[model samples]
Every structure is written in C-alpha cells, then in structure tokens.
Target: MSIAIKGGNIFQNSRPFFDEKMKFPSLEELTIINLRGIAELWHLANVEDEFPAFPNSENPGDSDALFNNKVALPAIKHIKMSLVDGLQKIWGSHLDVRSFNELESLDIKFVEKATKAFSLDAIQRIRNLKELNLQQFQLTGQFIERVGFYNDEVENSVLLPQLRNLKLDSFPQLKRIPWRELTLQNLRCLQISEIHDLTYLFPASICKRLVNLEALRVYDCHKMKEIVREELGDANTVEVKVVFPHLNFLRLSNLPAFQSLGSDNVILEFPSIKEVDFDKFQNPILWDLLQKLKPVKELQLGRCESLFELHDLKGRSSTMLPRLRNLTLSYMDNLQRIPWMIFPIKNLRYLKISYIHGLKFLFTASMCSEGFAQLEEIHIQDCKDIEQMLAQESIEDTSNNAAPITVVLPRVKIIKLYYLRSLRSFSSENYEALEFPSLEEVEIKEYDKEYFDLNTVIKKRCTTRLCYAR
Candidate 1:
C-alpha cells in the first residue's frame, strides 16, 4: 500500500498524524511533503512490535515516548522526502537503516545537513540500494565510502553492489573519487556537475571498471581538463585507448578549463555512442578524437574560441559524419567558415548557427558544388558579419567554370533570420541560384520589422526548387 501525506503539521515531536489506535501496517511506499517536524512518521513502520501510536495528550494514560523509540522501515522500497525542513536527521537516531533491506531508491534534495543525516554505517546497511541522488546539499568530507572512496574492501566493503545510478552535484571539497580503486561492477550511469576541483573524471585504475556504463555527463567543472586520464611510464611513449563500448550519450558543457578527452598519445573510442554535445574552447585533440568514433546522429559543438575555421574536411579521404542528422554551432567567436563540402554526408536535416562574430558566410561555394541538405529548417541568428549565406569565390580558370549549377533544399519549410547586421543575399556571384522548393514560412527579425521581399532575393540569387524537388 502507498500513502502520501500532502499537508498538515504531520509530525510534531513524534505525535504522528495518525490518531490513537491507528496502525501503519504492510506499508510499501511513503511520501512526505512540507512537514515541519524532526520525526519522520514513516519510522513507526520500523518497530516490529506495536508501540503507542502517538501520545493522546488529553488522556493521562498516554505517555510521551518520542526519544526512547527507534523505528526501521523494512518494507519501504521507494522514498521521496521534499521540503520537510524540520528533520534534524534523516537516517539519524530515530531511523534504523539495518532494517532497510528492501530500500531501492533514495532522492533527497534542497535539504540542509543531509550529509551528516545518514551515517556511513547506515548507508552500508542497505544491501539492495539501486539509485542515489544528492543535490543542493553542499556536502563536504568523505560523505560515503560506498560511493567510491576507499579501495580496500576489508577496510570498507563495497556497500551497494547492486547500486547502478549515482549523481553528485555542488560538492566543492570533492577533489576526486576513488571509483577506479573500488569495484562497481553494475554501476552504469554517473553524472557529476558543479564540482570545481575535479581535474579528470577517471584515472587509469577506474576507466576500465565502467564495463556497464552507458552515459557520462560532466558539467561546470571549471578545473576539469580531461574526461579520462592516460597512464604513463611505459615503453617509448605508448598510448592507451579507453573504449566505452555501450555508451550512447555524452554531454560536456560550461567547463572553462576543459580541454580534450586525453593527450594525443591516448585514444578514446565510443563505438555505440549516438549523440555527443560539447561546449568548450577549441582543442584540436577533440576533433581528432571524433574521427575515430562511431558516426553520431546528433552533434553539437559550441563555445570553442580557438577554432578559427574548420579545414579538416578539405580533402579527407573518409567521410566522418556519414550518419549525422542534426547539427548546431553556437558561441564560436573565431569560427570563420564551415567546410560543408568537406565531408560526403547527406543525412543532415536541421541546421542552426548563432553568435559567430568572425563568420562572413555560412557555407563556401565549394559546398554547393556537391549535394545539399534535405533540410526542414535553417536558423541563423546574432551573427555580426554574415554578409552572405553561400560565399562565392571567383575562379579564373575556364576548366573550373564548366557549368553554373543550382543547389536545391527541397523540403525547407521554415526559414528564420534574426539580427544579422550585415545581411546581403543568399548566394554569391558565382552560382546560378540557390533554391528552396517547399518554402512555407519566412520570419525575419531586423532593426526595422519592415516588409522585405525575401522571395525576390531567392528568385534572383538562389535557384528555385529543381524539377525533382517540384
């Protein structure tokens, strides 16, 4: 049975909301919200033998047993406690974790002193714990050894062998976790954010332990320079490759000190990864790493200041983005051009570019020489120097001027242009025209929201939808 206490002065000094003669029996799920009392009413379920439910203050026979009684929740599996501020201790004196044999999931947020609430001994008692999330606790010190601190099991046995998911955020004192030294055979998902001191996510000992890990997210770790650290001191500078065989999603953002996954000597591979998003200053090592991974369906790269222009696809033999579908580029101050023609890819459907000050054009004339996207939407915003969509390069050689080709975006339905201060036309003087066949809507937000004939620019500069598109 599941019971949720919505609103009340539920527990005032262990005088639970339940009146006299009421018993909490066969309870499985419990939720308490905004109850300002140190007594967690669920503790009553722990005491095997029935105790006086609550002191009947009006009756002389009722005795106050608040401090003397200790309770254990053996049947409760899932627990969510929110806004119960008066809780002096969570797994403290009143609650006994040894009886929490069936506890599976615990989520505690926006509470104070939650770090000291549950003693390390209490956490080690639950053998079946699966998920633990601690947020906004501002915790310090070795919060829990089971969360990958001590390596030696004889000293501190791996508490939750069944634990699969763990999230720790906003811990400033946490410099590093001893995950590599411990054995977490089943732990798969790990997310650490706002931890400033962590220089690297995994050391040499822990990288290989994540055999079941699928997703890794590290955010706002300003001092974090690498996702994984490579071990050294071997032969003539040998490199080690760490492969996350089942990892599918990886997101790294707001990490100012963040650089590459590892040094050029160490290689990182994600064979099953499908999506990757990175917002960091440009590190050539990162670009070099992407060439070796499985083709991603969604790729976003932003806030990279060192990337002046992407010149890798100039004559690369193998196409890197063979399975790309959605691409976004933002906050790239030094980026000048995207060599769209550099790769032989056609799966792209949506494209967005914003906050690029040095970009003079979106694509080069070389890009139009090849194929175009089966695009549905194109959004270009806040670009200070985007004078043209497709840049034109004047070629003097007659052999290069064999024909004037038209590139068509057949299914373009929505086109949005905003704050493009130096807007010109879509195409340059070299191409015949760039065409959008199925254009339905065009929203242009400029200094003056005046009616501008965007269709006229398309008709004169860009090619209309080709016969196949029509």
Candidate 2:
C-alpha cells in the first residue's frame, strides 16, 4: 500500500508513471524523492474525453457530469514528494474531482519546479485532508491562492474543511498569508519557520475563528513585525479584543524585528497558556506580555538584551511568577544579579544559567536560609565575573551577636559548574555550612585549581561523582 522512489531516473519522459489500464485501487500512500526525468505523475492523452467539464470549472457541480468515469488512485490517502526536479504537476488535467478524495495528508518539500500541488478543481474535492506541510517552494502564495476558498451565491465554501494541522517553512516568495480569503476553522497546530518576507502572522478577522488552536510556533522569521496586525475603522476609534481561549503552548525565537503582539488599539489575551519560550528577542514589549501571563509554569529565556532585570518588585510581598517551577536563562548580557525577592524560590525545582557575562553572583548569604529549598538540579557555565556561588552578606539581626547562617539544599541531587573563570569559592565566606542532603553528582570544568580545592567544597557523605575537565 506504500511506495517510495528515491535517487534514480526511473521514468524518462512526461508520460504517466502508471499506465491507463493499470489501476491501483488500494494504493494508499505514495512517496517520491530525488527522482529525475518525470514531468507529470498521471498524464491522460485525451483530456476532453475524460474531463469534459474541466476547462472552465470552478466548483464541484461543474465537474459532476464526469464523476462516474474511472479515476486513478481513487483510494489514495497520503502523498509526499521531495527533490523531484522535473515534476511540474502531481495530478494531470484529465482527472476529475473525485480522483483523490480520500487523501488525508500531503507533504511536499524542495520541489522547486512544481508550480502547484493540486489543481483548483481537485483541491475543492479533498474535503477529508487533515494535514499539509510545504517547504522550499518558489511560488508559494500563488499555489495557495489557487486552492483558496470560493464564494457561491448560495453559501461560502472552504477548500479544505477538515484540515487540522498546517506548516509552511522556507517560503522565500511568500510575503503574507491571505487569511481574509481563506477559512481554516478546524486547524489546531501551525508551525512556520524561515519565512523572511512575512510581515505579520494573522489579521483581526481570522483570530476570532481560530478557537481550536492549541500550539503556535513561529521562528527564524526575519521581517515579522507583529504576531497579529491591528484593525481600525474609518474613524480609527474601534478596538478589537483578540483572545486565544484554548492555546497553551507558544514559542517565538530569532525574530529580531518583532515589536508587539498587536498595536495599542488591540487587546490580546491568552487565558489558558501555561508554557512559553523566548530566545534572541531584544524588545521590552516581551516583558509587557509576560506581566499579563501570570499562570505560566515553565519559562525559558535566552539572549534577550532588553531584560536587564526582572520586573522591579517594588517591595511587593508576593512573587510575579507564583506558579513557576522550571526556569532557564542563557546569554543575558546585562543581567548582573538575580533578584531573589521577586522569584518564587520555594516552588522552583530546576534552574540553569549560562553565558551571563555580567552576573557577579547568584545568591546573597542572607537569601540562603529559605531560597532554593525545593531545587533539584543546578547548572552554571561560562560566567566570567561570578566571584562566588553565594555572596556573603549580613542579615538584619536584633542581637549584637548572631550564629553563622547554614545553607541547606534538602532536595538538590546534581550540580554542574563549567568555565567559571573568576569563581574563587563555593560561597564568599566559607564552604562549611552548605549541605546537599540528597547529593548525587558534581561536575566542574575549566576552573583554576589555585583558587579552591574541590575536595574541600563538597563534603557530603552521600555517594557522588566529581568530574573535572581541564
């Protein structure tokens, strides 16, 4: 039921790969990769005899007269083609609308010569399709326009009504998505990457209809300025409320030109979001969005130049991210210190920091008593100015004499420190009070042996592995 052809001159001309008499009623999946010398997959010699209603057909009824005739690959459900240099068309003009009605998934990549995936008449009949992934195409917008929705006097018809997932990547010629003309109500997941010309992802008209979207990821888009463009009336006074009720996962990375989610006139809200990832973003608008996301549990931030500090806590008793559990920070060029007052240290379990050039220390001595009590793992790397893991500082005390503070990490199991050029000791004062009751493994790399001894730093009685990379 499945056929894959790769790296060969299997066919020599524009002839049909399957003869007219050879019927593949059970062929469900077909894949062609790196094939040469083939212009058309199915070529009918007499076009008018097989499809009398094909020339001016726009809707299904115009071709209904030829539906009774036998069609090729009637029950095919999946098709994928890649690196087919000479493939100009997948379905010949002679085929009627009912040829590949059962198709559920189509994946086409790096086939530059192919102008269109499906004919206008053929696309209207693929009502059962669920997934479509296209990448590295020249005329991507033209192909999408041909398969777009059609408006009839009686009703508005969608081209792919059953589609659930759509991904478009490396579309060099696509400047914008024609959301005003197309309707994908059932779409759940959309991932786009390497689209350099796209200005915005969605318009206000289509945001209301995407009620079922669960995951949306857009990365490596150089010219994308906004996730959604604002819509204004003739008087420029109307405001739009855009909400993604079911969306839970969002990732935006390597988008240097992105400024805001939408203009000031548009209000955007994501009530159900739980996880977010942002990388290489240099705008303060990202912080504004984070202030609105109070329910996030897992957050990853890397190379954000605008984030000099976490939102100024302003002496608030409660933390901003009360539900946060997992956090990762990397390449934060200007972050000099971690504001422990604004972090939910009691709930944090996993922490990783790397390439923070300006960070002097991670925690102050006064913060060690209650901070990171539930933390399980710690990883620190490439921090050149970190003089100590925990800075020595005095806590406010009523009596003149106070006992030495003991730092207890009751749940920590693993610790890794790499390439810390200025690290002098585990703690600024001494390494005696630190206790890792659940200690498992400790790894240190590229450190100066003259500064401190590893054996003196880790004295836990539990089994542990100490690895040093020179």
Candidate 3:
C-alpha cells in the first residue's frame, strides 16, 4: 500500500534482509518500504554481467543477485520498489507488474534505467490497475518520439487501456505524445505539465475516439510550438473537430506555437467547452477566436503582450459570453482599455482586473452602471492610472441596499503594491467608504509601509489577516 526508499546505505544492508540467498515473504498482503540509501559508496552491482572481466578491485557482485533472492509478496495489493538497483532495464524478462494480479494502484518514479522501456507487455500485466503515476523516470525512446535516437517501430506500442488518470511532468526528452500507442477511451482527467520538448499532443484523427475525456490541460511546456497546425498546411479539417468537441475545460500556457483554435473555414468549435485559461502567452488569431467563445462561463486572459483591443469580445458578438460568471484580466502589457461599454454579463458575479500597466481608463464613461450593478465583486489592483474602483456617478444605488452589487467581492481584500515607488496612497479621498463589508484577509508582499499602516485601514467589524512579506 505504501513504499519509501531513502538513506545512503541501502545496498549494503539489502543483503541481510533476505537469507544467504535473498528471499522475500509471501503473505496475503505485503508492503516493502525501502530506506536503503545509506551505503558509503553507491555501486551498480547489476552492471557486473556486462563488465564481468573487470579487475577484482571493482566488482560489486551480481546486481540481479540482490533482487533475485526469493522475496514472496503473495496477494500483494501494493508493490513499491525504491532504489531498485537492478533496474538498468525496466521491462526485463524477470520484471512484471501483471504478476501482482491484485495490484490496484502503481506509483513508479526515479527508476535509473535511462534506456529501459516500460513495454506494453509490462503495462498489460497490470490489468486491474485503476490509477498509475510515473514521475521523474528516465524513460527511453520506446514510448515517445523525437528522442535523440528514437525509432518509429518502438513508438507504435499499444495503449494502456485500464489507466484512468495520468499526470506527466518534467520529461524533457519526449517530443511527441504517443497518441496511437495508448488507449484513453476511459480517461476523465489528463494533466500534462512541464514536458519541455513536447510539440504535438493530440492525433489529427483520433480526437473523437477519446470520448470519455472531460478535462485537458497543458502547461509550462516551453518548446511546444503548436497544438494542431492546420494553418501551416499540416492538419486536416476534420481532425480538430473530433478531438475538442466534447472538452469541457481547457488550459493552455506558454504554448507559442499554438496560433489559432479554428479556421474561418468552419465555426471554431468546442461547443461543450465551459471554461478556458490562456495564461501569459501570445498566439495568432487567439484574440480573434477567444472573442468567439459564446458559451464559456469563465474566461481568463493574462500576460498576452500582443493583445491591445477587445476586438474579439466585440461586434454583434453573437459569440459574446452571455453566461460568463467570472472574468479575470491581468498582466496584459498591451491592453489599453476595456473594449465594450457593456461591462460583463448581467449574470457576471466576479470581475478581477489586475496588473494591466497599459490601462488608463477601464471604461469610457464615469458611473457607467447599467450592466455592472448586478455584479457582486469588482477588484482592481496595480493599474495606477485608474484612480477609482467604480466610476463616481456610475450607480445611483451606492446605498448598499440594492441587490447586493458584487456581493462576492465588494472590496479589494488583498492589495500588494510591492516596489511601486510611485504609489503615494491606496486611495486619496473617502478611502474608508470603499466597501468590502465581508472582507476577511489581506496579503501584501514587498511593499513600503511608510505610506499607510494596514492596522488602521482595516474595518472594525471584519476580521482581516494580513501577511506582509517585506
């Protein structure tokens, strides 16, 4: 059920745990938590077979001998092997997960076998596996493509059918997501993050085959150039449709190669999509298509240096999000103003506007309250030129009684004007009138304390927890 591998001398002590010939227990249930990193010198005893004729001074003994010792893990519901030295090959003839017929979950990481493959045969062994996580392992060119010496023959391995949830991080060598090798018809949530060299993920033709896929997230992969590069004359028209049709939530970050979602060729689809996060990246037609998201409930746009207008959120905009509940705009170095006079949707409950240095006026008119009065929360931070939270004359009902405007976030709860040498004060007049009757906590980092003492600014009735990291 659980396993831990630690300490510096595990290799030396592993000999005594077993008999004269290593042997393991055969029990109805077994747990092997290794803490054997205690050895003074780390030696690969397993390498002896390959370099057997070496001088007598260097031999550590047979690597497989340590593991070959009979250790019975009968009816083992869990099997964890840490600091397993003989793993110069992951799918060796002696290694198998299927042998643990009762195994339900598997977590394997830091396997030193750099060139070893976790073969389809190895994965097929875990027929009952419900959850599998492989983190920080040195996988070879067997599963993914474009590794230094990859061969297509090894890339065509079969998929893992029983695996439902998968998280991949920090596999820099993997260039392509092995789409055809793995069957993910049952997968519900997929998170692929920090895979630096991964370029193309989804297959052009098999998007619809992943029928059960609900959430697809790709983040922090720097070298990834494109998702489906049809505009480059590469992708087929039909493939993009089948893949993203059923997706409900999608997040793309730092993917510079991903230029557009759909062509004018057809309505940029993703009909079932409910939320999208485009964080800190620039793309071609990204704003043009983002403007077309009609049914999206939450849209977050941040750090797009090329974005200057809401041309995407304009026009009769049949695509304007009518149901959007939360809209977050932050760190858009190029954004100058809010594009539309009609603030967010009447149903919009939370509006977070932060760190857009280029913004001078959020809206053209002051006291522009027609579409914003229904909003429960409005947060504006770090846009020095925007002097007021809400335009002074925008709402006739400043009376706190009308329909609980922006009730969710009535005031700025956390304000960090860190290193903002120009900021003289949070507000110049009637700062006390700023409403956040329910505000409870605040965190300020790297800010000058000479201008205002936080203890004096907080409301008497509300409990505020302030974390100041100066």
Q: Give per-residue CA lDDT, model 3, range 21-78, as digits (tens).
A: 2223343333333433221111223323432121222223333322321333335555
Model 3: lDDT equals: 0.52
What tens-digit string does per-residue lDDT give for candidate 2 at 321-351?
6788888888887888865676677888888
Measured with C-alpha atoms, the lDDT of residue 291 in candidate 3 is 63
Candidate 2 worst ten-residue window by lDDT = 58-67
The lowest-lDDT stretch of 10 consecutive residues in candidate 1 is 59-68
Ranking by TM-score: 2, 1, 3
Q: Candidate 3: lDDT of 391?
A: 31
* Root-mean-square deviation (CA) per prediction: 7.1, 6.1, 7.8
Full-model lDDT for every candidate: 0.64, 0.71, 0.52
Clashing residue pairs for model 1: 46-72, 180-206, 433-462, 433-463, 434-462, 434-463, 435-463
- The C-alpha local distance difference test score for the whole of candidate 1 amounts to 0.64
Candidates 1 and 3 compared: the better one by lDDT is 1
Q: How many clashes (backbone N, Cα, C below 3 Å) per candidate?
A: 7, 0, 30
lDDT by residue for model 1 over 202-302, one digit each (tens)?
Answer: 86546676778888888888898788776563342777778777788888888777667765566787878888787774556456646765467777788
